[model samples]
Target: MTSTIARPAPDATRRQDSAKPRRETRLRALDGLRLVAALMVAAYHYGGRGGAVTEAWGSSPKVQFPTLHAFFSYGCLGVQIFFVISGFVICMSGWGRPLRSFFASRASRLLPAYWAAVLLVTAVFALPVVAYEAVSPSDALVNLTMLQQPLGVDRVLGVCWTLWAEIRFYALFALCVVLPGANRRRVILFCALWMLAAAIAQGVDEPLLDLVLMPQYAPFFVGGIGLYLVHRDRRDAYAWGIVGVSWLIGQHYVVRELWRAPSPDAFSNRTSLGIVLVVTLGFVAVAAIALGWLNRLNWRWLTVAGALTYPFYLVHEHLGWVVIHALHRGLGLASAETFVLTVVSMLLLAWLLHRCVEKPLTPRLRAALSRTR
Candidate 1:
C-alpha cells in the first residue's frame, strides 16, 4: 500500500513564509481606533454641521450645538482615518493569503451588514415619512450590489459612497498585490505605482483615472501600506520613504480639496491646517502603532467596539436622520436631547445588528464563499 501527500515547491513555501510578522494577528488598538472613527462619523452626521436632513433639527445644527458643532466640522475627516486604517489592515490581512481567500474574507465581512442596511433603509424610507429622497426597489437592488456609485444608481443609504471607495481599494489590492501572493516587494511596488498613477491622474485631470486611482484618497491608503511594511521591518528606510511621500501628497490633496470640492457652509471656514492636521495625525497614529509606540492599547473591550463599527457605519446616516427628524420634530424633543438620544439609539441598533445578523452570518458566508470554485 502506498499514500501520497501533496506539497508545495520549496520556493513557493518560502514565498508563503516570507512575511516576517504574524500577519493574521489582531491589533487591539486598531479596533479601538476603528470604534473611534465610527463614532466621529456618527458625531459628524448627528451633531456636527447639523443640517444633514435640512431642518431635521428644526433649526441650524450650528445654532443648536454651537461650540461642539465647530469642532465636529472636522469629524468628516474620520473617513480619511478609516481609509488609512483600511490600507494597513487590508495589507496585513491579505499578506500570504490567496486571492480567493482574501475575497471570501472581505465579502464575508462586508456583505452581511451591508445587505441588511440596504434593505432596511429601503423599507424604512418606503413609508414616505422622511424628507429625504425615497429609495425605490430598483435603487435598493442596485445598492445591494454595492456598485451603485459607479453605476450611477442612487444609494439607499447615503454612506454607501464610502463603501464604493473601500471595495475599489480591496479590488485593487486583490488584483494587483494579493493575486500575486502579497509580500514585501509586491506591496512596495503596489504603493509606489499607485502614487505615480495618482499624480498623473490629478495632473492630467483624467476623470477615469481619477475615478480608478482615487487621486484624492490614494495617499492615505498608500501611507497605510507603507506603515504595514514598516511594521514588518522589510526595509525601514524604504518603508519610511513611502510613508513620508504618502503624507506629503496627502497634505497637498487636503489643501487642494478646498478648491476642488467646496464643503457645506458650516465647514467652509474651518482652517485648511485643521483638515491637514487631522489627516496627518491619522498617519502619525497608525505609524506610532506600527512602530510599537502604542502597544499598551490592548484593552479587551475594544474588540467589541470594533465589531460594531461596520454595522454602526452602515445603518447610521439615514436612519439617524429619521430618528433626529422624529425626536426633534415629531416628539418635540430639544435639539441637544435629540442628538444624545439619536446617537445612543444608533449604537443600540448597531449592537443588535452586530449581534443578530453580522455575528451569525459572517462565518456561514465565509464558509459558503470558501466552497466556491
Candidate 2:
C-alpha cells in the first residue's frame, strides 16, 4: 500500500467497519506507538543510572536530569510495550501466508539490520572508545545466532536480550498457531496452553523451563495477539477473554518485577502503580486502535516512523552512549546539548541503515529464503 491514503468518508466507512471489521486494513497509529516505545527505552538508557552514561555524567543521572529521571526510570518497561506491539503486528502479517513466506518475512525484516548492528557495535567498542571491554570473538559469533541467551553466552550489545525473546516467541507462534491456520479458536488455544506452561515454568523454578516459556513476558505477547483478534473479528468474546486473562497475569508480573528489582528504582507501591498504569495504557491504546476509536489517525508520518523503529532500536544503545560520553567528556559539551546531539545522530544513523542496508537487501533476502520453500 502507498504510505498515504486519504481518509475515507467517515460515516459509511465507520458504519461498514463497525458492522464488519476489516481484517486487512493497516493500523496506522501503531507505527506512532512503536516510535514512542523506542524513544522511551532510549530515554531510560541515556538518562537513568543503568549504563556507562552515568560514569561520564560524573554524578547520578537522576541528579543531572532531576525532574526527567523520575519518569525515565520506568522507561525500560518500554520493552514490554514492544512485545505487545510485536504480537499484534506479527499475527496481522502472518495470518494467511504459508510457513516459508511467514519466516521469510520475519527473517528479512529482522536479520539484515541485526547483522549490521551486531557488527557495528562490536567493531566500535573494539576501539578504546569507552571503558568497556570488547566482546570475545567466540561470543560475537554466537551472538549472530541471536540465541546467545539460551546458549549461556553474554550479549555483545545493548537491547539484544529482547531479541532472544522475540526469536522464541516467533518460533512458538509459527509452529503452533500461524502455520496451522490462525482462527479465533486456535489463537485462543495457544494462549491457554502458553499461560498454563508459563505457570508451570514459574512454579518449577527451572532455568530451562523459564527460558523456553518466558513466564514473565508470555502475557504481553498473548495479550497482543488477543487484541489483534478483537481488531479483526468485531469484538470477539473469546479474544476479549484472552486479553483479560493476559492482563491479570501481566499485572502480577509487572508488580513483582518492580518490587524485586535490585536497583535505585526498586520497590515502592507508587512505582509499581506507575508501571501498572503505563502497561495498562499501552494495552488500552491498542484496544482503542482496534475498536476504530483511532481510525481518524491515518497520518503518513507514522508510517515512516514505523519503518525507522527496528533499526533505531537495534543501534541506539551502545552507540548512543558512546556519543553521549564523547560529546560530554571529551568535547566538553554540556549535558543538555550532548543529549540532543546524540539523539539526533542516532536518528540519522538509523535512517541511513534503513535507506542503505534494509531497503537494498531485505527483498533479496526474502526472495532467496522463499525459494527454498
Candidate 3:
C-alpha cells in the first residue's frame, strides 16, 4: 500500500520562509543621515563655542565664521540623532542574538577603533612639545576601558563622555533582551517602564536616579525602538503612539534645556530655534526612513560616509584643536584658513583610520570572539 500524504501549500510556504535568512532592510538614507549627524557634531565642537584668541585652545578662530558658528550651535542636536540611531540599530542587531552575542557584537564594533584613537590621542597629550597636559597613566588605563566617566575617572577626550552613556544604554537594552525575549511586546513594555522611571526621577529630583536612568535622553532611545516596532509591524497602533509621544517628549526636553543658555552672539535666538528645528527634523527624518517614505536613497558613497563617521568623530575635536593652534602659531595660517585646513586634515585622517583600523580589525575580532564561544 503506497499511501502518500498530501502537504498543504501554506505549510510549504511557511517552511520556505523559515528556512530563509531574515535580511533586515538596508536603508541607505540612514547612512546619509549618519554622515549628517557626524558633521553636525564636528561643527558643534569646532565652531559653536565662540571665544577670543587669547582665551584658550584655538576657538578664537571661530569668530571669523560667526554665521558658521551660529548654524553649528544647533549641531549638539546631532548627539540626540545618534542616540536614536543607536536604539534602532541595537534592536535590529539584538533581534535574535543572546545577551553574550549582543555584548560581543557591541564590543567588537566599538572597542578597536576607540582603542586606536585613544592611543593616538594619548601620544599627543604625552608630548611636552604639544604643551597639552599629560594624561596620567591610571587615567589613560581607565580611558582604555571606555567607561571613564561612570567609573569616576576623567575621560581622555572630552567627547568620550557620550560613549559611557552609550555603553549604559547597551547594558540596559541587553537586560531587556534577556528578560522578556526580543519581541514587539517587550519593546513597548520596556519603554513604558523606562519612561515611568524617568518621570519618577524627575519628580524626586534625585541625582543618582537621574544618573542611572539618564531620563533626559531615554525618550530618544525609546523613540528609536518604537520606530523599529512600527516598521516591523505596521498594523500596531500602540507602537505608533509610543513613537509619537516619545519623540514629542524628547524634543521638548532638548528645546527646554538648550533654550536656557543661548550664545551671546547676534544669532542667539536664531541659534536656539535652529537647534530645536534640527532636532525636530532629525526625529521626523528617522521616522520617515523607518516607515519606508525615503527608502529609495541608495547611494553607495553614503555608506563610505557612514563608515568613516565613527573614526572622524573620535579623531576630531581635541586633536583638531591642537592642529588649529599649531597651524595658526607654527605655520602662520590665518584663523579662517586654519579652520579649513584642520577640517580637511581630519577628514583624511578619518578615512585612513576607517580603512586601516576599523575595517580590517572589526571582522577579525568578531570572528575570533565567535570562535571562542
Give me the candidate number with maximum TM-score. 1
- List, residue by residue over 285-348, the lDDT tens digit for candidate 1: 8887887677788888888888988998998888998998898889999877988899889889
Per-residue lDDT tens digits for candidate 3, residues 66-92, read 567667667888999998887788877
Per-residue alpha-carbon lDDT of candidate 2 for residues 1-373, written as tens digits (9 for 90 to 100) = 1214444576754444333223576678998899899998988888854457677666567677877777877788889989999988887777666788889999999999999998988898888756667789899988998878778896887699988899999999999877776655677789899999999999999988998899999999999999888876654688889889988889889888865544555321236778788889989988888777887899998888889999999988889878877888789898789878988898899999999999999999999999963
TM-score of each: 0.91, 0.89, 0.88
Output the lDDT of residue 363, model 1: 96
Model 1 weakest 10-residue run by lDDT: 1-10
Each candidate: RMSD to true structure? Answer: 5.9, 5.7, 5.9
Question: What range of 10 consecutive residues in model 3 has the weakest lDDT sum?
Answer: 52-61
Error of 3 at 231 (Å): 2.1
Task: Please list the residue runs of candidate 2 whose C-alpha ends up more than 4 Å from where it truly belongs after superposition.
Answer: 1-23, 260-270
Ranking by TM-score: 1, 2, 3
Candidate 1 segments exceeding 4 Å error: 1-24, 259-268
lDDT for 154 (candidate 1): 79
